[model samples]
Every structure is written in C-alpha cells, then in structure tokens.
Target: MDQLSATLLSAPVLFFILGALAAAARSDLAVPETIAKGMSLYLMAAIGLKGGVEVAKAGFGTELLVALAAGLVLSAAIPFLVAPALARFGGLDRTNTGAVAAHYGSVSVVTFVTASEVYGNTGFAIAGFMVAVLAMMETPAILSGLFLARQKGGRLFAPELLREVLFNGSVVLLLGSFAIGALLGERGFEPISPLFRAGFTGVLCLFLLDMGLIAMRRILKTRALTWRLALLALVFPVINGAIGVLVGTAIGLDAASAAALGILGASASYIAVPAAMRLSLPQADAGLYLAMSLGVTFPFNIVLGIPLFRWIAESLGGML
Candidate 1:
C-alpha cells in the first residue's frame, strides 16, 4: 500500500495522469510526434547501454541464461493461453484474437522502464541481464501470433515481414546500444554517462506524459474496444505477472529480478507487436488491439501493476 501510494504520487506517474486528463478533456496540449519518437529512441538506448554496462561489470552468468530462457518461454506460451480466451469469451475473430494475444505475450518497453524506476526508487537492484530478456521477449510472440493467424496456403512470414520483425528499429537500437556499452564498460562509459544517466528520469516523465495523452485519445476514438475486451486488458497483466513471479522465484532469481520478470509479463506490447501485426495480420483490427494494449493495459500497469508485481515477487521470495 505504501509502495503503491508512493508510485501513484511519483513525478512520472503524475505527469501521465495529467496527460490523460488533458486528453480526456479534449485539450490542445500535445507533444510533437517527432520529439516523442526521439525520446523513445533515447530511452531505449539509455536502457540498453546501462544494462550492458552492468553486465560488463558483473560478467555473464547462469542467471542471464536462465532468465532469457524463462522470458522466451513466457513470450511463446502467453499467446497460446490468451488467444482462446479472446475467442471464447471476448468473441473476437481468429485474426484479432491472435493479434491481441500476441500483445499480451510481448512487452511494453516503457512499462518496463517505468517499473525499473519504481524498483530503483524502492531500493531494489535489477540485474543488467533483464534488458537482454527484454530484447529477446519482443519477438517470439510475434512469431506465435503469425502462426495463429496464418492464412491457409500462405507462408507464415513474408520475407519483408520477417525482416521487419527481426530488425525493427527498437530491437536494433536496444541490442546495438547494449553491445556498445559492453564494449565500453564502466570506464569507457564515463565520458558520456552524464547524458544517458543523469537525464533519464526527466525524459521518461515527458515520454510518459505523451503516452498518457495518446492512450486516452485512443480509448476515446476507437469503437472496436468492447467492454469484454477492456476487462481482459485489465486482467491479463495480473494473471501473467503472477505466473512470471512464480516462475522467477522457482528459478532462484533475486527479488528485484523476479519482480522485473513479472513486470515484463504484465506488460503488453504497443510498439513491436503492433508493427509486426500490421505486416503479418493485416486483417486484424488495429483499433481494437491498440486500444486494449496502449489505452487500457499500459495505464493499468503504470499505475497499479508495477507495485503489485513488486509485492508479489517479494512475497514469493520470502515464501521460497
């Protein structure tokens, strides 16, 4: 409860709420799209570089391998679990169901970034390798989504789509920045540390403010999001996050890493998955998936899900 309160009152979350309210009220307040895109790039690069630097300092270990495997399993398996529910309960057709499922299986990098901030504020040490987990977790759900929505006699992936999914800008920047950071190490990173390290939180606040406005506007404008689908958007994070926490605990992760894993599970991808779906499942309802993921799920995770996952991870760690 204390953690939750603190999170809700934090600068980033408050800015997000402000953005949402402004959008809901139909205010003219807006971030320029180009600036938002630039911020997104900056955030990913900062996250990647820091993660790689940490890995360099600590060196690769079994934890990285184990966490990677667990993340892969979750990303691959979540769509299978979610697609049927969307079909049976939400009454979405095959294409849209698979599309939404792919989102839950994938992750929102902003959500992860926000959670990392929350955890950092709360004094938890997130392992550097989790960024690798983040990078790896982005793609498998895309493949799973493609398989679920594959048209009869159609190839699962067109050459172009495969390229798009594999070399998406986000993935490239993240992985590329990580490699650069690893090469640089702490000493090598020192010269540019002020840029990536010092200004991270403030940039995140602005980015999330933009996100909040975008999300609320999406919800307001989209007709495809039914009540049932909205409810699933709220629910999937809790269930998936719990499973992730349990798996992390079982795998001997520390509390922070376990919670980070839970955060990843709880998040739904708005970036990578949507782009992939656009290419592969062209028939899928973009409005519906975007509304559920960006409008409904993203806010929920930012507000409540981060703290919830942290508590769950801590509880499970204590029990173990």
Candidate 2:
C-alpha cells in the first residue's frame, strides 16, 4: 500500500492529476492539437526504435514468441468474459457493454509507457519485445467486441469495424514504427539515436500533460459516474492484472517484465478504442466507456496499479 501511495503521488501521475484538475476548473490552458499529435508521433517512433535496438541486442527468442501469443489470446478472450458481467451488473446494454469491454481488454500505449518509466526508475529491466507485444494486443479485443455485438444483432458496419481494428491512428503509427525500427537494426538506430533516445522521456512528459487535460475534461463531463460503473473500472483492472501476472510468471518473465505485463492488462484503452466505439457503437453512450476508461481506469493504473503489480510480481518471482 505504501508503494501504491508513492506511485500515485509520483511526479508524472501528480502532473496528470493536476492536468485533470485544471480541466475540471475550466482553465484556459491547453495543448495545441497539432503539437499534441506531433508529440504522439515522436513518442511512438522513439519507443519503436528503442525496442528495435533492444531486440537487436537480445535477439528474438522463444520467450518473445510465448509472450506475444499470450497477449493475443488475452486480448481476444477478456472482452467476452468482461462484457456479460458489465451488461448484467452495470446495466449497460449488450452493444455498449461489448464496446467498453473491448477497450478494457486492449492495450494502452501511454499506460505502458508510464509503467516502463516506473520500472526503469525502480531499477528493473523489462524486455524490449514487450513493445511489439503491446502493439499486437491492441486489436484482437476490438475484433472480439465486434463479434459479440454482432451476436446480439447490433447494427455495425463491417467496413467500420475493419477501419477501427486495422486503421486506427495509434495502431497504424505503433505498428508502422515498430516495423521500421525492426528493419533498421543497430546501425540505423545509431544515426537516429539522438532523435529516439535523448528526447524520449521529455516527449512523454508533454504527452501526459495533454492526457491530464483530456482526462480532466472527461471527468467533468461525466461528473456523477455511478458507483457501479466506477467500481467496475477499478475492480476489473485488478482482475486483469492478476491474470497478466500469472501469464508472465508462467512465461518466466522477471519481476519487471511481469509488472509491465500487469500494467498493460490493467490499463484501459482510452484513445484508440474510444474513436472506434464512436464509429462502431454509436448508440452506446460515449460518456460511460470514455469516463470509465480515461477518467477512472487510466489514473488508477498509473498511480496505484503500477506499484501494486510490481510488488506482487516481485513477491511471486521470489517464491518461484
């Protein structure tokens, strides 16, 4: 609990909370949209390059394959498990529940980025291939959500689902950059080292500033999120984190890698999934999922879940 509290009060998380507060207070301060977008691109590219460099050093192996496969399975399975419970307990209709559950099952790159920072600060080493794993995990839950929605006869266009799953901005940029980085290898990365390495954390800070503003804005818009929904957001991540830890342990992940996996599982997708939901599940109230995701789950994972998962993973690793 002390660790959790410390994490919650960490500089990045607090800055995010401050951003939320500023938004709640309706402050005029804002990140320019273009600059925000540019920051996102830079972060994605740099992270991809870094991951590629690490992979070059480590070389691809069975652990990477196993982790990737586990990520895909989790991404596909979690939404099916979560949607029904949300529908019954939260009073979300089939379509809305499915949409929301999909986001929960998907990866949040920003949250992953933050977790990596937390791990680094704590002197834990994480796998370089985890970034690729993160990218792979983004879309399968979306596909699952669409399948579940269709089973209920929800009105969704096939093209819209395709676009959402394959062409979403974050998905495209993340995978595209990962491919570029993998192709470039060590020699290529050296020339781009200053661009990808030196500027990474600074760009992340700026992005979080924007995220803080956005989270704050969303919180204000949904001022009275129901206890049921809020509780769902909080509890679901714990459950997901547990599953992640188990998988990570089985795959022989070290403490830091397991913690990072826990963080990924616990984090909800706010950006890509929301955009997809808006297009694919138009009848579903954006307020419910977006609020639960950006407003509730994202903050919870960053402040509380990161440390808690890290501790749990460490304890479990020691026992093993």
Highest TM-score: give the candidate number. 1
In model 1, the Cα lDDT at residue 76 comes to: 94
lDDT of 1 by residue, 36-88 (tens): 99999999999999999999999989988999999999999999988888999
lDDT per prediction? Answer: 0.92, 0.82
Q: What is the TM-score of each candidate against the true structure?
A: 0.99, 0.93
> Which candidate number would show the highest lDDT if scored against the true structure?
1
TM-score of 2: 0.93
Q: Which ten residues in a row are the worst by lDDT in model 1? A: 145-154
Candidate 1 global CA lDDT score? 0.92
Q: Which pairs clash in the backbone of model 2? A: none
Q: Candidate 1, 283: how far from true, in Å? A: 1.2
- Which pairs clash (backbone N, Cα, C closer than 3 Å) in model 1? none
Question: What digit string (tens of lDDT, one per residue) describes model 2 on residues 4-55?
Answer: 7766766677777778778878898799999998988887777777777778
